[model samples]
Each structure stands twice: as C-alpha cells, then as structure tokens.
Target: MSGIYIHVPFCKQACHYCDFHFSTSLQYVDEMTDAICTEIIMKKDRITDQVGSIYFGGGTPSILPQKSFEKIFNTLTTHFSVASDAEITIETNPDDLDAKKIAILRQLPVNRFSIGIQSFFNEDLIWMNRAHNAAEADSCIMRSQDAGFENLSIDLIYGYPLLTDEKWHSNIRKAIGLQVPHLSAYSLTVEPRTALAAAIKKGKQVPVNDEQSAAQFISLIEKSGMAGFDHYEISNFSLPGKHAVHNTNYWRGIPYLGIGPSAHGFNGNTRYLNIANNAKYMTQIAAGKLAETVEELDIYDRFNEYVMTSLRTMWGTDLSKIERDFGKEFLNDTIENSETFIRRNWLENKNGTLTLTQDGKLFADYIASELFLIDEQK
Candidate 1:
C-alpha cells in the first residue's frame, strides 16, 4: 500500500523535549499551506499507486484553521487518486480541539486523530511546556467522541523525571478508560539543542533515567495486553485491525509522497527530504522549483533499512523475502548474525520468520544494528 504525509510546521508553543522542526508563530501558516498544496500538485506524478492513507503530521497540524485543512484536501483530491476509504489522519494537540474546532473538523474528511496527550498530569505538562492542561487532555477525547470521531489514538511519554510508577499506571488506566483504539507511547530522550537537553546540561532539570524508562515500558506492555490491545509495534499499541495504515505502510517499505517543509518521502529506492524552513519552502514552491534533497538507495542500504524497520514490528523479519530480494548471501549473513540472539532467546526464528521476543524488544535498536549488512560483514 502507498501513502501520503503532510507536515505542518507550526505550533502554539515549543515543548521542552521536542526537537521536530516547527515555528511557534502563525505568521506563515497560510503561505505554508499554499506551498504544501503546490508541492502536491508538482509531485503528483511521483505517486504511481492509489493513496490508501494520508497523514497530517506536525509541529501541530491542529493549529491550522479548518480552511487550511479544506484547501489542502482540495489540492490532494485534485492531484491524486485517493482511496474511497483512505485512512486520513491529523496529529493534534489537546488544547486545539475545542467543541467549535471539533465541529469544524467533522465537516472535513479527517477520519482519525493522533492526539499528543503526553500526560494527564498538570506537573508533567508544565515540565514539558505543553500548551494543554490536565483538564483539556481529558476533555478533548470526549469532545472528539461526541463529534463522532471514534478512530482515535493518543500519545504518552514515560521515563521523564516527574513520572512515578504510580503516575504511569494512572496514565495507562486513563487511556484504557477513554477506550481509545490506539496508543503510541514513547520514552523521553534528551536530544541536543532542545530545552530539555540544555536544562540537563545546566542542572536546571533532571535527566531521563533509562532504568526507569524500561520498567515503565514493560508496565505499558503488560497493562495494554491485559486490556486486549496488540503490542503491534515497539512504541504503538492498538486493538485488532486498528493499526495505523499510514505508519504500517511506512514500516512495510511501501512508497509514499511527503508534502510540506521538513517532510520526508520514499518511493521504493529513492528517499527525499523537503527544505525545513517555511519561508524558503514557500519561495521555492511559488517559483516552481523543488526544495528538497534526494538519495538513491544501494542494495546494502535497502537490506539494512528493511532489517532496521522490520525488527521493530510484531510481524518479524522475513528470511525468504531477504533471499528473494537481496540474494541468498544476504539471507545467510542475516541468519549468521541472528544466531547469538536466537540462542539468548531474544530473537526467535521459526520457519524463516525472525521476530524479537518480549525480552529482546528492550534492546531492539542494538539487536537490529548487529544484524546490519555492514561493508566488512557483507
């Protein structure tokens, strides 16, 4: 399946822990939206398959007005053949989803909402500098449900200094109580140049505890399983058949066209990233020039990419696919590299499908890297 991703690079406030490209000012939102629409028109030829999913990812897609959404939707439908039941999603913040706004959205084609409700506690929101409060977090879900948007997912953060085990449990319980079909939880990482990183450097805030993060993750897995949710991806949990189509397509190496500034796209072998600055992106798009960088993948690059993405998924890596797509030599190398982990019970290889055990998922990144097709290893 193929998909489309549009990045909205405007936000009301900058979260201390976030490192994604976005601007706090709305001065350029209209221009940015226009540029995104133009980019879609300019690159429609690159999309060879029907778009089964279209995701509006952020900065904060919700910050845009309903007209912006309508304009972009018009452009998309005009340019590409969107599937009748395409999984169209918008990533939003809690503070942005008022009754009025929800009503506005109900008129649009947005069928899914990926809310950034990092926590349900005021302290946590304060620490992260999230614009929404505890009240808004709880209220937004109900508002969306009332507005008839039932296909919802929420984000939660763990391993932050303020989140206690008790609090983490409460967060999970809250999500379960809300009956959201999907949940995407992430561990807080201190990326360089971000407020969180700077605070840690100057001793203004505490650093993240890995051990604490691990325990919280395991707790999430256990709780979600008890609630009948699939631990589908390392960071995503969902009820059966509720997996995010756009993200699932991405993990499975399907082609997608990415629109807007800072968005990335992959069409089987070639990958591209659009210019990150809003003004520059608009200028280039207005001038009928492309503001992006592209790279063509080599065989080894493709193999390593598959290994990296597939290992994080519950479906596991396919050995036969490797042999068929990357040759038997690559398949043999994969099996050889996987031996130690399989012996350790972190990875299980059954009938040519290699998957990470529950225990191995904690070290998934390191394990996938070990199975990489490095030059010497290849």
Candidate 2:
C-alpha cells in the first residue's frame, strides 16, 4: 500500500538545529496552500495504487489554520485513491493544540497526532527556540485526551547540549505517564548549516558529547523496553499494535507521494525531492511545474537504501528479499559483512533475518555502511 505526505513548510519560530524546509514568515500560506493543492491534482495520475495512509508532516502541520487542512484533505480525496480506513497522521506542536484545534482536526480525516513535545522543561524548549513552553507541553496532551483523542504520539530530543540525563529522563517519563501510544526520539546532531552549528563554531553553544548521547540512547532502550514499548525502530518506540502505519509503510519500501517544499518521495525504483526553498517551490508549482530533483535508482543505491533503513528497525534486513530483489551475489556479500559485527555481538542473525542488537544499534550507521552493496552492484 502507498501513502501520501503533505509538507506544510511554515512554522511560527525556527528551531536552532532544524534544517527542514520551513519559513517563519507565514505571509505566503494562502498561496502556498493553493500551489500544493494544485500540485496534488497535477500529479493525480502519477501513482495509481490505493493510499493506505496520509501523513501531514512539516515545520508544524498544526500551525496551519483549520481551513487550510480542510482544503488539503479535499484535494487528497479528490485526486487520490484513499481508503476509507486509511491512517491519517499530522505532526503538531503543543502550542497550536487546543480544544478548538483538536475538534477541528477530528472533524477532518486526521486520525493520529504526532505532537512535537521536544522537552517537558521550559529551559530546553527555550534552548531549542521552540514556540511552545513547558506549560503548553504539559497541558496539550491532557487536553487532547480530554477532547476524546486516542492514538497520540510525541517527539522527544535527547542529548541536547542543554539536556541533562535527569532532564531527559523526566521528558521520557512524562510521555509515558501521559500514556502516549507512540514515541519517536532522537539524539541531537548539529547539522553543518544550522544555527546551532554556527553557535558551536563560535563557542557560544556547548558541543554535544557523543558518549553522553550514546548513554541516553541506551537509557531510552532500557526504559522504554521496561515500560512495554516496542523499540520498533532505532528512533521509535510504540505500544503493541500502535506502530505508525505511515512510517511503517516507508520502512517496508512502499511508495509515497510527498507534497510541498523539501519533501521526499519514493516509488520503489525512483526517488524525488522537492526544492528546498519555500518561494521557489510555490512559484514553480504556481507555474505548473514540479519543483524538485529526481533520480533513477541503481542497484547499488536500492540495496544500500534497504540496508540503511531496514537495519535501523526491528525488522532487520530480510535475506529473502535480498536474494529475490538484489540477486544471490548481493545477498551473499551482505551476510558476509554482517559476520564481523555478529561476532562483535553488535548484530544477530535470528532465523535468517539480520537484526541489530542493542549494543550494535549505537553504531548502526557504521554497520549499515559495512554491509552496503559495493559500487559494482550498480
């Protein structure tokens, strides 16, 4: 089954470490909305598969007014073959949530809420330059629950320069206590071009300690596991039967259409990315062009993608798929490379499926690299 992702590239404030395409100036929201809806219609014939899920992710999808969301859904239903039982998700910040917002969202097709609750501490919120504070984070979940919404999810950042382990523990425990169904957590990495990167370069911001970050990742695994949450993906944990259908589709290599600025789409053998600039994307789409880069996937690229995405999740790399899709030589090399990591107790081959052990997960990228199909696979 395929999915559709709508990128709402507007936010009220910029997170220092965020490089995701978004603009704080929302003056172009109305035009951007129109361009996005038009693009969906224009690309209606691109993928003929039934949509199993629809995800609204972005700078903050909840930041859009209710009418904008309605228009997006109207366009989706009008142009795509969406199932009646499709799992529709929207990413939101706590500040934009209220009874009015939740009620309005529920009235539409949104079935899941991926709330950006980066921290339960006001100081961490401020450090991240998030618009929402500790108070809003505390109240929004309760308010959402009170509004009769279940299947709630939250995002958390750990090992931030300002986040102590105690503080990080508090954040995780808060979400657990709130009974959030799904949790997506990440270690803070300062990307090269972000504001946080500049601050650290000038010694204004403290550097992130890899050791500390690794420790917190371990903490997340142990704590969440003890709490009965499935470590479904390296960065995601969920209650049983509560995994994100949209993201699950992605990891399983399902096709999805991504809309708006800086969005990425994959349809098995090909991948595309929308232009990163808000203005360029809007103007191009307004001119009836898809503002994006496209690439035809080669064998090496496809095999490597499978290694990278599959190794990061509990599903591991499937040997049968490798043999079938990538051929015998590719499958053999993958198993051979995994032997060293398996000997080091970093990975496991259980029932012919290669999966990451908790210790191996800390170096997941390195392991994926070691197992990547050589360039000759191309």
Candidate 3:
C-alpha cells in the first residue's frame, strides 16, 4: 500500500542543531495550507492505490489551526482513495500538546503522535533552544494517553555535549516508565551553517565527541534491551506490535506521495523532490505548476537503494530477490564483497539473507556503501 506525507514548514522556535527545512515566521500558514491542499488535489489521479498511511511531519504540525487539519483531510478524502483504517500520524512538540489541544486532536484522524521530546532535562532543552520545558516534556505523554491516544512515539537526542551518560540513562528510563510504545533516538550531528556548528567553531560551545557518542549509542542498545524493546532499526526501538507503519513502508521501498514545500515522493523506480522554498512553491502552485523535479532510477541505482534500506532493518537483504530481479552478477558481487564482513562476524548470511550483527550496526552506513555497485561495475 502507498502513503502520503504532508510537510508543515513552520516552527515556533528554531532549534540550534536542526537542518530540516522550516521557518519561524508562521504568518504564512494559511497560504501554505492552501498550497498543500492544491498540490494534493492536482496529483489525486497520480496514485490509484489505497493510501495506507497519512503522516503530518513538520516544523510543527500541532501548531496549525484545527481548520488546517480539517481542510487537508477534506481534500484528501475527496480526491484520493484513503483507507478506512489509515495510520495517520503527526509530529509535535511537547509545548503544543495541552489538554484542550489533545481533546481537539482526538476527534481528528491523527491516531499516532511522534513527539519531539529531545531531552527530559531543562538544561539540555535550553542548550538546544527548545520551545518546551522539562515539565511539558514529561507531561505531554500522560496527557495524550489520557486523551485515549495509545500509539505514541517519542524522539530523544543523544551524543550532545551536555548529555552525560547518567542523564542519558535517566532519559531512557523515563520513557520506559511512561510505557511509550515506540522510541526514535538519534545522535547529535553538527550540520554545516547551523548554530551549533558555528558555536563550536567560535569556541562558544563544546564540540561533539565521537567517542562519547559511540559510547552513548551502545548504552542505548543495552538499556532498551533490558526494557524489553526491540531495536528493529538502527535508531528506532519499539514494543511488540508497535512498529511505525508509515516509516516501515518507507524502508520497505513502498511508494508515497509527498505534499508541501521541501517534501519528497517516490514510486519505486522514480523520485520526486519538491521545491524547498515556501513562497516559491505556493507561487508556482498558483500558476498551476507542480514545483518539483523528477528523476528516473536505473538498475544500479535501484539495486544500491535496496541494499542500503534493507540492510538497515532486522529482516536483512534477500539474495534470491536480487538474483531474480537484478542478475546473477549483482548477487555474486554482493556475496563476494560480503566475505570480509562475514569473516569478521559483523554480518551473517543465513538462508541467503544478509543481516548486520549488533556490533556491525554502528558501521551500517559504511557497510552499505561498501556493498554498493559502482558505475564501472554496472
């Protein structure tokens, strides 16, 4: 089944380390919503399959007015064949989740929440310039649960200078105590041109330590294991039967239609990237244009993408599918190239499925790149 992703490009505050496309000036929310709805309607005939998931990710989807959600849903229902039990998700900040707001959301189609609770400590929140405080971070979950929203996922950031080992442990324990169904943890990376990078360069802030980050990552795995959560993905943990369907579909290479500025859409063989600028996107949509670029994937590109995504999951890579869909040469190349990793016990090829061991997950990106077929090989 296919999916739909709507990007809300406005935020209340700018986090120091974020590099995603977003704007703090929210005066353009109405115009942006209109543009997104128009794009969805314009491409309604694009995907005839039933939409299994609808995700509202953003600068802050919770910041939008109730009418925005209504309008978007109205457009989607009218134009596309949305499934009756579609997994609808929204990304929110803790400060935006109040009782009144939760009550309003419970009536909508948002069945799941991906809260950006980066840290449970006020010190870290201030360091990251988050909009919410420690109290709000801890309370939003209970509020959502009280509102009868059971499917909950919270994001936690590790590997920052201010995050100590003890504090990280506390963070994980906090989620366990809250009985959060899913957890997505990430290492703090200093993107170029971000405030964090600039502060580090100017010695205004402590630089990120790779050794410390690696140590924290290992701690996360062990802690989550003790809590009975499955490390299904490199940075994601979930209780049984609590995996994120939308993101799972993405890793499995299912096609999805992306809406709003800076959104991306894929159809197994081709990719579409929307214009990143908000004003320009709306202006182009007003002129009856899609404001996007498309790319057609070749055999090598598709093979490499499959290797990258499948290898990251617990399911591993399917050698038979490779041989059947690609060719014997590609399968042979994969098996031949995987010899060193297998010998090192970093990878295991059982029944023709190759999977990364616990230790190998730290180097997942490196291993995937090594297994990639180069231009000459293709």
Candidate 4:
C-alpha cells in the first residue's frame, strides 16, 4: 500500500539546529493551506493504490488550525482512495498539546502523534531554542494519553555539548517511563547555514562530538533493548508490533505522495521534489501548476538507492531481490563488496540477507557507500 505525506511549513519559532524548510511567521497560513489542498487535487493521479498512511510533518503541523486539517482531509478523501484504517499521524511539539488542543485532535482522524520532545531538560531545551520547556515536555505525553491517544512516539536528541552521559540516560529513562511505544533519538549534527553551525564557527558553541554521539547511541540501544524495544532502524526504536507504518514503508521503497512546500514524493521509478519556497509553491499551485522538479531513476540510481535505504533498517538488504530487480551482475558486485565488511565483523551475510552488526551501524553510511554500484558511463 502507498502513503501520503503533508509537510506543514509553519513554526512558532525555529530550533537552532534545524535546517528544514519552514517559516517562523504565520503571515500566509490560509494561502498556504489553500495551495496545499489544490496541489493534492492536481496530483491526484500520483498514487492509484489505497493510501495506507498519511503523515503530517514539518515546521510544526500542530500549529495548524482544525479547519485547515479538515480541508486537507476532505480534499484527500475526495481525490483518492484512503484506507479506512490508514495510519494518520501528525508531528507536533510538546507545548502545543494542551487540554484544548488534544481535545481538538481527538475529534479528527489522527490516530498517532510524533511529538518532538528533543530533551527533557530545561537547560538543554533553552540551548536548542525549543518552543517548549521541560515541564511541557514531561506533561504532553500524559495529556495525550489522558485524551485517549496512545499510539505515540517522541523524539529525543543527544550528543550535543549540553547532553552529558548522565543527562542522556535520564532522557531515555524518562521516555521509557512515559510508556511511549516508539522513540526516535538522533545525534546533534551541525548543518551548514543553520544557527548551530554559525555558533560553532564564531566560537560561541562547541562542535558536536562524534565520539560522544556513538557512545550515547550505544547506551540508547542497550537501554531500549533491556526495556523490550526493538531497534528497528538506526534511529528508531519501537515495541514489538508498533513500528511506524509510514516511515517503514519509505525505507521499504513503497511509493508515497508528498504535499506542501519542501515535501518530496516518489513513485517506484521517479522522485518529485516540491519547491522549498512557500510563496512560490503557493503561487504555482494557484496557477493550476506544480512547482516541482522530477528525477527519473536509472537502474544504477535505483539499485544504489535500495542499498542505501534498506541497509539502514533491521530487515537489511536482500541479495535475491537485488538480482531479481536489477540483474545478476549487480547482485554479484554487492556480495563481492560486502566480503571485507563481513570479515571485519561489521557486516553479516546470513543466508543471502546482509545486515549491519551493532558496530557496523555506527559506520552505516561509509559501509553502504563502499557497497554502492557506480555507473561507469557517468
């Protein structure tokens, strides 16, 4: 089954480390909403299969009013076949989930919440320029659960200078104690042009330590494992039977439609990247046009993409699928390239399926790069 992803591009404030496309000002929210709905109608033919999942992600989906969501849903149902049991999710900030907001959400079709609770410490939150404080971060989960929404996931960030080993442990323990079924923890990385990068360049902040990130990541895996959570993906952990359908589908290379500015869509063979500029996206949609560029994937591009994404998951990369989809030559190259990593114990090829070992995951990008099939013509 396919999926739909809507990127809401408005936020109350910017997080220091974030480089995702978004506007802090809510000046043209209504225009943006109208344009989003129109784009959905225009791209109605993108996916013919019943959409099994719908994810509202971005600047802050929680900031949108109920009417906007209602309109978007209405437009979606009108144009396409959405599965009755579709896993509809909204990415939200902790501060947005008050009693009133949770009540409003319960009235909608939303079944899951991906709350951004980057850290459970006020100092850390302040340093990150997060909109929510530690108290709200602690209470929002309980509030949502109290409102009868239990399919929950929370995000946590580690490896920043302010995050000591002790604090990282506390953050993990707090999420586990909250009884959330899923957690996504990421190491802080300085993206160029983001506030964090500028701070480091000016000596106002220390650069993120890679060693610290790796150690905390190990601790996260060990702790979550002890608590009975599956390290399903490198950065995502979930209890048994609670994996995120939308993201898991993305990793498995299932096609999905992307709505709103800065969102991306993929069919099996091509990718559509919507223009990141909000104003331009809205204007183009108003003119009954799509402000997007398309990339048609060649066999090499497709094979390399499969290797890149599939290697990051618990399922690993399948050699048989590679050969069946690409060719025997591709499969042979993969097996031949994987031999070195297997000898180093970083990779394991168990019965034609190759998965990263615990140590291999730390170097997943490098390992996958070494295994990629480069096009000689290029």
TM-score list, all predictions: 0.99, 0.98, 0.98, 0.99
Whole-model lDDT, candidate 2? Answer: 0.90
Scanning candidate 2 in windows of ten residues, the lowest lDDT window is 369-378
Compute the lDDT of residue 146 as modeled in candidate 3.
84
Tens-place lDDT digits, model 4, residues 1-378: 999999999999989999999999999989999999999989998888899999999999999999998999899999999899999999999999999999889999999999999999999999999999999999999999989999999999999999999999999999999999999999898999899999999999998999999999999999999999999999999999999999999999999999999999999899999999998999999999999999999999899899999999999999999999999999999999999999999999988899999999999999999999888989
Off by over 4 Å in 4: none
Better of 3 and 4 by TM-score: 4
Judging by lDDT, tell me the better candidate of 1 and 2: 1
**Candidate 4: lDDT of 287?**
92
Residue-by-residue lDDT tens digits, candidate 1, 122-237: 99999899999999999999999988999999999999999999999999999999999999999999999898999999999988899999999999999999999999899999
Q: Candidate 2 vs candidate 3: which has greater lDDT?
A: 3
TM-score of 4: 0.99
Q: List model 3 lDDT by residue over 207-232, tens digit each.
A: 89988888999999998988889888
Which 10 residues in a row give candidate 3 its minimum summed lDDT?
369-378
* lDDT tens per residue, model 2, 193-293: 89999999999999999999999999999999999999999899999999999998888898999888998899999998999888889899988899989
> On TM-score, who's better, 1 or 4?
4
Which candidate would rank higher by TM-score, 2 or 3? Answer: 3
